[model samples]
Target: MIPLGGAAGRVAGLVLAAGAGRRYGGPKAPVFLGPALRVLRDGGCDPIIAVLGAGARRTRAVVDLAGVQVVDNPGWAEGMASSLRLGLSTAARLPEVSAVCVHLVDMPGVSALAVARLLAQAHASCLTRACYDGEPGHPVVLGRDHWAEIIETTRGDQGARAYLRRHAGHVTAVECGDVAGGYDIDER
Candidate 1:
């Protein structure tokens, strides 16, 4: 794990793969977990954490989660918020992890380059994310300073939307459409 970050900090990768993916016919985590993990690893996140829900058993059976910390979210059916809280709570235990780059499993177009660009300027207090042609996208880099509030405000499938919107002015948007696409897959 690379414990390196700009201005002295460690950024952990948080993969939210707990969704049931009903529209996609099944859980997308088992199918795309590997690629998502590679994205964070190659991008520069250390001590990655992947939260599995719906197909937890199947995902674990087929996916290779050797180095990454696999977190099973029993309340995953509640929503993405549960996975986010669980992942962030796990990250909070690591004193070395100063921030987390949150990525979604359904977003296959999101590349390591996009994650790299976001992590390039990450720190303990920086709120950054990838923007595709001025539109906000995934791979949101959340600083440790804002975790408590995010965990409190997020509910259901909202994730960190409430917190991000509340502090939009402080969030830094990094244009990554040049290197990757931000489109998420919803159907088979």
Candidate 2:
């Protein structure tokens, strides 16, 4: 367990890495897991949790997940929602986690700076997302208060888009264009 935060807040990094990466020809988790973990760790997120499915076994064999909590999602083939649900559930179980900064395994361009920017704004009810040039992107910070609703609303590959859209008035968009690119790797 991570040390509880004093006044700022404690945020956990949840990496959605269960996809089989059909477009990229294989699981990107094995190739990019380390970078994802590094981004989260360097950004100040504690008690990180990585959810794996498709290549869970291979990813475990190739990736060094020391000090990081790993969760295996058996329903990954259904879509990214499964991974998000599993990751969120795991985060909710961590008593010290006030918020979760979600990162994608295939998004190599997302840097620690972006994650830090988002995490800096974390609060018990804050809903923040990293946006590049006004474009909403990864490393979305969902406070613990909203975990249950997000888990209930997210479906398929939509992730938390639907919830964010519905609550745009409450969501904070942190500009990270200077620190990271929002593009995700979809092909070789």
Candidate 3:
């Protein structure tokens, strides 16, 4: 497992933009969400690495966020696991990152403060997740120490579900009084 605070001792944001978006018919990463770039970026987090796959270039083309790095995941077509792995691996390498808060492009409404709160709560209680009002949601925060544990069970688009399912006991349900936690554009 990646030891807590073993890296640069700060959090790095991982924006999962590598999906093929078969239903959306194009790259969803470049899809604009208000004034912010399609790739999620927020306070207290280091640079965001927009993991790209399928239409890597096309999705990244429209993102105008400065200092945002784009990393291609060859395994993206294989599934979401590859993108997760690629993102986590990149987070592991950053000199200033000790944790990763995963944000999905489709869920653009999740606040940066919500993510920070989860991380803070986890560090205090040794928790791994802050479920959004009893239901799990995006922007799952993982301490550096949990990296190795997650990397082992992760393989594809399962995203963080595998890790969350196995460690359900470590999850803390949180109520943020916000709809972003419950909102998902793709949900029908």
Candidate 4:
């Protein structure tokens, strides 16, 4: 259980694990869900939300859904945007959540330490993204102020790429390559 209230404010974690893993042969959820949840929990994120779609039943059967809130994205087949929208919307409803840290299940290289770094560098009114060797990547932190806009602009699998690009000036990039890798295991 995460302690409530800190200088950094209360931040919820949103894990996007609803993908069908069409290229990975089977559901990536069974492989990544547990570790992902552990990373978020250990990183001090409260009320972590894991969005499930493809193989939801199989994932539930294999993964331990203990402390996290599992939200099923029925429209997940549409793409990542639906999951993102579900996560952001759910986070917004929590009065204690001032920001959200979004993580992808496929990126197992991302560590709890890197998530801690992102949370530590997060600003109340600015966007923060983990950087690998100076290149922006996930676990992206988005302040409540940007949630609505992000939900509005996010589409398909692009996620917040366009919105972040347009508001690059307001983003805070934290270097975490030494501690974690932001590689996506989409194939094989």
In terms of TM-score, which candidate is strongest?
1
- Native-referenced Cα lDDT, model 3: 0.64
Summarize candidate 2's per-residue lDDT along 24-57 as a digit string, tens digits.
9999999999999999998889989999999899
| Model 1 C-alpha lDDT per residue in residues 52-160, reported as the tens digit of each score | 9999999999989999999999999999999999999999999998899999998889888888888877888989989999999898999999999888778999899
CA lDDT, every model vs. true structure: 0.90, 0.89, 0.64, 0.87
TM-score, predicted candidate 3 vs. hidden true structure: 0.81
- Runs of candidate 1 with Cα error greater than 4 angstroms are 1-7
What candidate 2 gets wrong by more than 4 Å, as runs, is: 1-7
Q: What does the lDDT come to for candidate 2? A: 0.89
Task: Give the TM-score (vs. native) of candidate 4.
Answer: 0.94
Q: What does candidate 1 score on TM?
A: 0.96
- Error (Å) of candidate 3 at residue 94 is 2.1
Q: Which of candidates 1 and 3 reaches a greater TM-score?
A: 1
Q: Superposing every Cα of model 2 onto the true structure, what RMSD results?
A: 2.5
- lDDT ranking, best first: 1, 2, 4, 3
Query: How many times do residue backbones clash in model 3?
Result: 4
The TM-score values for the models, in the order shown, are 0.96, 0.95, 0.81, 0.94
Clashes of each: 0, 0, 4, 0
- Residue 99 lDDT in candidate 1: 92
RMSD of each: 1.6, 2.5, 4.9, 1.9
Q: Clashing pairs in model 3? A: 2-145, 80-157, 81-156, 81-157
- Supply candidate 4's per-residue lDDT for 112: 85
True lDDT of residue 165, candidate 3: 77
